[model samples]
Target: MDPIDPVHGTATLLLIAAAAVVVLLFLIIKVKLHAFIALVLISVVTAVAAGIPIADIPTALTTGFGSTLASVALLVGFGVMLGRLLEVTGGAQVLADTLVNRFGEKRAPLALGVAALIFGLPIFFDAGLVVFLPIILTVARRFGGSLLFYALPAAGAFAAMHALVPPHPGPVAAGTLLGGDIGVILLVNLPIALIAWYVGVYRMSKVLGRRFDVGLPSLLFGEENDGTGSSGDTDTKTQAPPTFGLVLGLLMIPLVLIGFNTVLSTLIESGTIAEGNILVDGLILLGNTPVALLITVLAAIALLGTRGGRTLGETQQLLDSSLGPICSIVLITGAGGMFGGVLQISGIGDALTTSLGGLGIPLLLQAFLIATALRVAQGSATVALTTAAGLIASQAADLSNVQIALLVTAIAAGATVLSHVNDSGFWLVSRFFGMDEQTTLKTWTVMETTLGLSAFAVAAALYPLVS
Candidate 1:
């Protein structure tokens, strides 16, 4: 739908937007409302308050929600399914073990972190952490040291990649709204994520690990099993685990495919390659993000599932299980888009641009600060990233693709910081690593802040250079 003419003056629209955000935070944080419901409710209320006609409210809501899901749902669904296959088939264990063996015991934490960065490409933070739990605990038990040494690096890598990289919902939604090329976002952010992880998470973790000697928790693995060092699954023990090469190869498939699309499209745009050729068209189609991930998932089902002797029915069941956990993530993200849609149609974006434009803050920094505020208020990084992107979509309309990709990176950086009591990931880390609230605040929260800062720093430095 076209943006409705501003029914209210700039001051009034800005106030309505601020009020909507405050209510959103209160509903989610204090009243304990679900993010999806809270977002929808606020979208409607904000629309009416901002003088949107009653007839247009539903259209605004659905337009934003549907558009977001169009880009988000399939990628998230297929990505998680692939992750579940890897997790269940012992792909994660194989990767970690191979890395640790090569890196040696002295570099176990580095090895685990590297494994997580690779494994984390298709997996969400919580699921990846859960899948890697046994491996992390097993290694910690063998080496005997602060759990922080092992846990923080691996966990932080997942956190960084999930926030910064594509195929994860947060960056995907942000990139879509900001008009970024997902492939470019993926390619650019991949190296930046690795650098940020090393400096912000890896180096800092070493210091924190030494300072806090957090003992291993008996939550998942009991005492005796630590000595026996099982892979934590009876099925994995019976079958020959997938080799490290197979696991890495499977993970690389989508990356390579998507890279093909990005490089070809760039060449076509530059007039280096004709766009109408059959082979080029076929390659680009296969390289599309959802299509690439779909191909990967199908390949995984065959190679990791049926080839391993599981029946098709069993494989279907495994893939189906992965979807269940991500439903909330997908829904909340769609709702965030709805909220952003309301803002757009209500003319708040224009008002925001006009208002903030005078402040003389760099757009990159502005994006980061807005995302940081939303993240701290609500505790969902996906919500913060998507909503912030929606709010700034108008301002970003004229930016180069590279700049928009950088904006997504900057927004992601903001959403990643200051994960405290409200963030689910914070509690997950606390309970899994057996740290208390205070200790979690001291370590995990600090590391998240550093990680976010480092990512933003990289994006900020790159922003001026690109344009």
Candidate 2:
């Protein structure tokens, strides 16, 4: 539907801005340009293209950059460090091994799937993949199974949590930005995610199994080498896995604290922060994701460092190495924020949202479609999500809590569709699964598309219920 309103101009401007984002992502990822630099370059391009006054454009850019970085920088940075510590200590593998031992053979895929669901509850998707990949590989080998079986289930489990759960960064970030309840998001999304994963980890994987052969694909990066006990990878030891207490405690601290604070703030009758509840206060403080992750990083440093008899220098080195690749991601995402913020402030989003009015589609579907188009083009789910959220945030006031939760999931699913050469996740999975680029495109990428569309299909199914 077309509208003959002033926002029509704004709508066009935003469509251009959104398209610029995907183009920018494509250039960076497919053209081998660095994402960080590409994002900055694109932000400037968007500013000029939006016809933002020269005087205000720079400020808009700076404000967007600063605000966006402040929102997610700490969580992403600390999360990177935490995942690194976990990986280097063999903690991720140890956990999977322990779980498989407990769950046994008849249902190994189920066991790995469950491991991903639980472990993914507290970590970012990329970080989770890097840490858990080793264990997944090990399990695949142990069960005499195809990599597709274990990897698909594991990916399904992880994807479900990443898309639907809270205290993990995506939903939490969406919640904080929109003033939605982290607790309610967790409560609401748990069932949706569980329901989705039931379809994904179990049924979806099996359904798609014939199309994808298992075992590490030969074309996977460095797959032929096997790189055992390398200095970069986890080293095996006679020692037990990192203490269950340490692992479980690190994972739960953020959830419990964040949940506690959310409840206390929502339910507490007294206006003032109680003076004697220092422990709860502390938990709440620890629960602020960045702080919680920092604490987890500290926990890993202490437990993993001492247990492995690593020196302080070595410990720091491990942490640093873990974060090496993430710096670009954080910065690129920040640039994306700047790009998103500019569109919002420039009144472009308002124009677009208004244009979509009276289209007779559910707002959630609108959100998903816009996000999916961007994702299918660029392959960066983060950009797809941030861009879509920035646009939809314009219409947020009109939505209910259930609707907001659905929108968040919708945005996530949209961002996940059609991983092409441009998406890092494609390459990561491609390399991990040992597919050549084409095969990776054929299988791993298609799986992601399946995930993105199916999640929305379920979300759409639930819309009438919510309405």
With a 3 Å backbone cut-off (N, CA, C), the pairs that clash in candidate 1 are none
Clashing residue pair totals per candidate (backbone < 3 A): 0, 2
Which pairs clash (backbone N, Cα, C closer than 3 Å) in model 2?
147-215, 217-434
What TM-score does each of the candidates earn?
A: 0.65, 0.67
Model 2: per-residue Cα lDDT over 125-192, one tens digit each: 65456445656665665555457777887876776677667755556666555556666767777877
Scored by lDDT, the top model is 1
lDDT of each: 0.78, 0.63
Predicted structure 1: lDDT = 0.78
Query: Candidate 2: global Cα-lDDT?
Result: 0.63
Write candidate 1's Cα lDDT for 300-415 as tens digits: 88888874577788778766755675666667767766777777677676665556545668789989987886676445789789988998899898998889888998999999
Best by TM-score: 2
- Return the TM-score for candidate 2, rounded to 2 decimals: 0.67
